[model samples]
Target: MSKIRKKKIKKTNILLGFICVLLAILLGFILVTSYKSEQKESRHLSEIADDQQSGIEDYEAVKERAKELEEISSEEAEDTEDIKSKNTEDTEKTDTAETEDADKTEDTKDTKDETAAAASGIVCWGDDLINGEESNTYSYMAVLQKLLTDNGYNMTVINKTLQGGGTLSMMKMAGVSDETIQGYITRHQQAANGAQLNVTETGIRDLTEEQTTRNDMDCIPVIFMGYYGGWNHDPAELADQQEQILNTFQNKNQFIVVGTRPMDGSVTSEALDQVLSQKWGEHYISLADVTAQPSSTYEAQQAMAEAILQKLQELNYISKN
Candidate 1:
């Protein structure tokens, strides 16, 4: 064939080969750039995953620390409560012990004072006015004993009064008369079984030797007899009876006599009260304006006891401490 035609064909073939080579190089460059970009995205995702894991771990660690703090606080609170409770218990125990000690001390002092009272005493005598006629709980002698001891007097009281309204009967109980208890009982029976003499039988019997346990040196005598002391209501007769009763005790001068108006103040009762007040002086408690019935009441007995307590206080029979 022609030489020029063959040369032109070869040039075309070379140009096509060069174009194919250029296209292959461009495709390789694009593939390599895509692969590098994919690798960079994977590295970024890995870094983000690592950061999230660290954050989760930090949150768990913080929760554990908070739980530890809560446990420590609970233990501290329990310890504080225990200490407070122990302190309160100790205080209560100390207070109770102190109160008990005070009570024991008071009891000891009272026992000592009571022992002193047992040695020295006061003896009382009257009709139903001072006896167990109303109620032994309201007995002036019993009440007086309590009052004396309460006021630090420490004085015991003995009652020799008759429940029945008979001055001779009371004198017999006081061992100031020779009248027998059986005789009194028999007389009571004759008077429609008047009163019980047996209740005060321990007071006396046939007794000059009965005075061995008691004497004027340790005892004081008190008397109030008006209801049936004498049917005639004579002041001289009452005075004679008073002398006899006073003589029964060894200390006749240190006796207390309470005189009250009988029959609502006849001249006899006034004269008797005046005579007793003059004779006994400071030892006499006069109730000349008070009626016999009023003097026999329980309230009157309490008043009489209060007056006796006053006189005893004036005589300095009680302790100040």
Candidate 2:
């Protein structure tokens, strides 16, 4: 081989070696850059995964907090309901106590009024027909009470008539045992203690010694009719018995006779009226003359009671308003 050719070959080999080394160095740089880029991407992905995990934990905490808030709300609601129920019970008890107090106060006022009235003069009435069961429209005693009250008089009217008997029975009752008569008056007072106007069916027999002495009885207006239990009584005998009863009173001037028309056609009302008028004179009052017949009827009884009240006022037996 020639020396020049050998030298040129040697130079070419050296150049080629240098070129390979440069290519290898470039490849290494490229590989290192690619690995660094991959590591950066992995770090970004890890950061994103950490953020997601944190979000999940926050969501769990929020859910737990919501559950706690709900439990608090439920407990508060139960407490509110219990408070409302207790308030309602207390209000009801207060209302009941108030009503009881009001009733007691009213009862006391009524008793006081009754006591004051009982001390004053009391008007008395008697007769089977007048003291009978009250009718739908008007009771004779009730009518009399209203008239007297309208005239500024507070009076308690008491009926002293036997259930089935007439004037004879009234006389007998007047002569009863003093203890028995006193007991009846006591019962009547007890029953009337709280009433505005007491109209009792206890007959004149209830007029005991205690009543006459303790209370000022101004007048006893008697309504006596002959007819009773579908039979007519003798007017003369009935008047005699009535007079006997009136004599028992401490003040005979308090007796006022009133005659009623017979319900039956067998007996004339004028017959009894004449007998009463002859005995009692100006003190006698005829129901038929004052109003109409059938004093048992509501309208007729009302008119008769009014007329009797007027007569009592005219005669000055009761104080005028």
> In order, what is each prediction's RMSD in angstroms?
18.5, 19.9
Q: Could you give candidate 1's per-residue lDDT for residues 112-159 as a string of tens digits? A: 445334335777766535443445667677678878777666566776
Output the TM-score of candidate 1.
0.46
Deviation of model 2 at 189, angstroms = 39
lDDT of 1 at 85: 88
- Across residues 39-145, which tens digit of lDDT does each residue of candidate 2 receive? 99999999999999999999999999999999999999989988988898889889988999998978756653444333344444345354424632366666877
Clash count for candidate 2 is 3
**Candidate 1, pairs of clashing residues:** none
